[model samples]
Target chain A: MFVHGLATNPGWDWPTFFQFFATRTIFSALWVTVQLTVYGTVLGFVLGAVLASMRLSSSPFLQVVAWGYIWAFRSIPLIVQLLFWFNIAYLYKELSIGVPFGPEFVHFSTNNLFGPLGAAVLGLALHQAAYAAEIIRGGIISVDAGQLEAAAALGIPRIRQFFRIVLPQAMRSILPNGANEVISLFKGTSIVSVMAIPELFYQVQVIYGRNSRVVPLLMVATVWYIVLTTLLSIVQYYVERRFARGTAR
Target chain B: MIDVKGVHKSFGDLEVLKGIDLDVPAGAVTVILGPSGSGKSTLLRSINHLEKVDRGLVRIDGELIGYKRRGNKLHELREREILRQRSQVGFVFQTFNLFGHLTVLQNVVEAPVSAQGRKRSEVEPYARELLERVGVGDKADVYPRQLSGGQQQRVAIARALALKPKVLLFDEPTSALDPELVGEVLDVIKELARDGATMVVVTHEIGFAREIADTVVFIDGGRIVESGPPREVLDNPVHERTRAFISKVL
Candidate 1:
């Protein structure tokens, strides 16, 4: 119904575009992308910090296991990780969901996490956790020996010592790198479209299908990506500033 | 107030301290004087169990410093228990190991607030007064790096005194300070001596030792070669090692 740059490209249609982007479907896709970024990064960071602590374990066995997990997950591409989980259900006939060796039992139909929204979340979160663990470990080790010794010398309880003294200081050192990880993770969610989870990229595809103007539709998706990344970066700077007090000295 | 008996220490095969014994009476200044490898700092550190002992025992406030009983056998105290015992005697390090991330006030209040379970409300005022006593009250809110070496060491002393310790240990406290700034920190130690808190100090300052110390001990090659009143030991010299050490410092 509308034409954009009519003189330059007589076929460049643009009138329905303003109304097209404002449609509920496009808006819902934007919200889904936001949810993925929020939940995925949170779950990933929590699991990653714990794993990083375990990775620094004194036992060789735990170290080997952690090393193996990081190597196996990180070396493969995220697209491959998603596909492997999606297809793995076909390989295994039975899906047993029960408390192992704990007198509890439940069973599920063989539905491996693939193609489903939950599977996308699970795949992204677990894969991100591997990289997040290394980031957290680097932050923790960057704190000086004197700070930990000073905390221990004060006789704070071991758990309290970590949260209050160790973690705050480590957060200051870790946050710049952590913010970058968050941004990368946000973009990484786009890979989920390959599995058909109906995210932002999927919505963009639907628009292009109705009116096959591929470049402009892709441009709309690119604009949303830039806006989201810019907003996240602003939040990151403030969060980093809050934690970095007294670190200057 | 403190007793170190037949204390032996080794860093693997190095044998940093050997069968050292000494008595520190309550409310008197004891200055330990020795050459670079004389184990002077090691002796001062052992009194507070900062440097763990290989054999023998240290007793402070009549409680054994390092050894604990386990099914009728003695074992080194656990970390938690070690902290409780060590808190009674505060140590000042040569390098002024002030927590760089904390302000002077936080550094002073840390041990009392966490180690002793004393309220910040009760400890903060006393810390401020102690900072005034050491003559660095103005530097209270400043971080350690912002202060001069002398000012930092004075803050270190204020930090030590914040706990109201029974005996204060100084391990070459002024050794790392510039020559001019040394007097400011030493002057505070001299005042602490006048107040009669049980004090054990290791120093390269012959003049500070001669002025404030009640007993002067000379150590060489991991043993106490001689000990007596500062006048007797520093002035008269009982052994060739003591004579040579004092002659060079004097």
Candidate 2:
């Protein structure tokens, strides 16, 4: 750490330039990266499952809607979507969290919700859901009709069968694909820097702009992302193994 | 406990089952033997509405099948009403369709717990007992993929029995098994017959029909050609088609 600072600026004391941020901004953004991934992944998975079911639904209207969504989102790159969502024009009205019939509980608008951190997470999540929908849809179809009949024969209702019998088998088909989505999501978070998310990429840009240490600061951001995605890959490996049980090795 | 009347079914231009009307008694084993494309399997599937019949009716325990909840012979019976009733008529396949994800114990207990709404804790012991009866008790914790062809078929039998069905249907149950594995499945069926369970079997196994069936039904070209006590039917057949089929297999 000391040598890196000195090498970047040798004329004066380097720690003065480094101490201001070493103790704060980069470290703070590290926390933001974690939060972005956690919140983004959760939101994305919930939305994606709904979208996938919509695509799988027998009704042509729903299938067409789902198809339209996937085509629009997946075709235009993730980086572009992240930027668009962060800007004012693209956002819908802010979220209003309230009881449906009773009373207005709370409302938060677009400006407030798209804070540096929120924008990053939201961008990654919405984009990720489209791909996840396709992954989940494929998994659901792979399950045989006979198995559903057997479940039906047991008098197990259709709704319960989706969660219980169908989902477990589908997990085997979906998890590997889902792992790719997660990794893609992690990469997608990089786009958040343009939204002023103050994530690793943003912090690196800030550091490089001030110090003219472009290569080193950019390298720092690159290392962090590599490490994080590598860790996610490890997690994915184990999840795939658990779901793939009893299938051919 | 089961009746079929004038059941006709077709697949596109190919007419599979042409006017199949057959009756099976309470607690009796009825074996259906026929050539390929003769529609024996189609006729059996039609009874449960698994394969829809263009025209005809199936009655199990006096309730008519293929009718709407309000439209037909039945005053009421939900789609699930039909499902629960159909659960009472278990169908075993040539390829054991035991759910690959679940353990043998879970497979055996799934219907009882989910369909019958029996407590899993209450049904667990019964499931184990059925597994043991089928000689797959040791494999109860194993998944279907982990078991042999014989073991999987037995687990399937155990799965069917988990429902404690009124009439068990076998669609060439042993036909998919290897030569060595076929005997184990047959032995399980023999035990089921002795226990007085009603069965409708589609099989090529002449000896099993002779040994265990109360009645042997020979269907040729979607029609019942000869049916009687197994010894009588297998020994001396009346129809040329039945005679020809028997001669070919022998």
Candidate 3:
């Protein structure tokens, strides 16, 4: 360990690395990164599933609305969306839940309604949802039409049929692509630094700005991302295996 | 008991069934034989509302299959109601569309326990009994992919029987199986016929139809060309179209 430390000690950058690790700030920042990823992915998945269902619905209005959501979100850059949501106070001074174009039952200042963390999660999740929706839609569509026909002929309720038969099979196709989105989202969390959220990357930037150990502190953030993504990849493998049960090779 | 009247079905520009009419009484086996693309399958699918008729009605046990008759209008049943109606009429497909992710037993017990709202414990034994009767009892715990074509088809039969429907429809059940495995599935159908289950079968197998059919209906160009007792239709077809089709197959 002494020899390795000696070999790696370039301009005493190791001290900054050690200092960053020893402080509670780095760990808290790491927590923020995890929170954003987990919540973003989960919320994104729910919205994506709903959007995919809408896209597949018989109603033309729903199909168009779903299509517009996906097209708009996916077409806009993630950074632009983050900025737009973070500065949403400019567009609407107050957020309210009440009748449209009528009296407001309740209201709150937009700036107070959403903080930086909320804005980051909202931007990341909504953006991820657009891509996730298509992935899920493709998966649902890829299932054999015969399966639906069979389920219908068997008299299984439509909702039950989708959950029991269709979704299970669809998972076989959805998992691989869904895993891609999750891993991408994990790394994508780094972009939240723009909002001054003080997540891992942002914290690293703050530490290096004070200490001037730029490259090494950046490496610290890089290593953490690689480690987290590697662990996530391992999880993806097992999840795919579980969903692939009873399916033909 | 199933009744089909003036059932017309068209796809795009091609009319598949041009006003078909037939009646299948309780405990009778009606075997429909026809050449490919002759709309025999379409006719079979219409009975259970899998294929809606453009102009006509299908009645099962004195109830309209997929519509609620109100006064002078027939409103299409909602999905939930249609599902409830379908649970009482079992169907077996040619390709054996068993749920691949489910085990044989799960496939059989699914419709009964979920759609029919029966308890799992209550349905399990009968599901196993159906599997045993279909000759796939030992394979119930296995996935559909792990089973042979014949085994999968038998599992499908068991699945349909689990619903305890008043009538069962088979659409070329053996056509998708290998020749060597065909008899296994045919044997199960033969046993069902002997038990006097009401069945409507659309198939190309002349021999199997001859052995089990109470009435053999021949279809050509989306119309029933000839229909009668097995011997009369199979051995001595009067219509030239039926004769030509039988001649080609035999």
TM-score against native, each model: 0.85, 0.87, 0.97
lDDT of 3 by residue, A1-249 (tens): 887875676854776677676468888999999999999999999999999999999999999999999999999999999999999999999888999899999989999988999999999999999999999999999999999999999999888999999999999989989989998999899898999998999999998898789977887888788889999989988988888878876
> lDDT per residue, candidate 1, B17-136, as tens digits?
999998999998899999998788778877877678888888987888878767878888787787777777778878776776678998898878887889999999999999999898
- Residue A142 lDDT (model 2): 92
Model 3 TM-score on a 0 to 1 scale: 0.97
**Cα lDDT tens digits for candidate 2, A156-178:** 66677788788989998798888
Tens digits of per-residue lDDT, candidate 3, B2-67, equal: 999999999999999998999999999999999999999999999999998888999999999899
Every candidate's DockQ is 0.31, 0.46, 0.82
Using lDDT, give the best candidate's number. 3
Best by TM-score: 3
lDDT of 1 by residue, A1-249 (tens): 233464366344445455566678877988888778777889889988888888877888888888888888899888888887666677775666677776547665547433377778888888888988898999888877656654554444556567766787788767888888888888888888877777888888878988787766776777788998999889988888777666563
Top-down TM-score ranking: 3, 2, 1
Give the poorly placed runs of model 3, Cα more than 4 Å off: A1-12
> Residue by residue across B1-250, what tens digits does model 2's lDDT show?
7899988888998878788778898988899999998999998887777777888778887877656545444343466766667677788887887788888888888888877888999889999999999998898887789999999999888888888788899999988889999999999999999989988999999988899988999988877888999887899998888888998987
State each model's TM-score restricted to chain B.
Answer: 0.97, 0.94, 0.99
Sorted by lDDT, highest first, which candidate order results? 3, 1, 2
* Prediction 1 TM-score vs. true: 0.85
Which 10 successive residues of model 1 chain A have the least lDDT summed?
Answer: A1-10
Clashing pairs in 3: none
Better of 1 and 3 by lDDT: 3
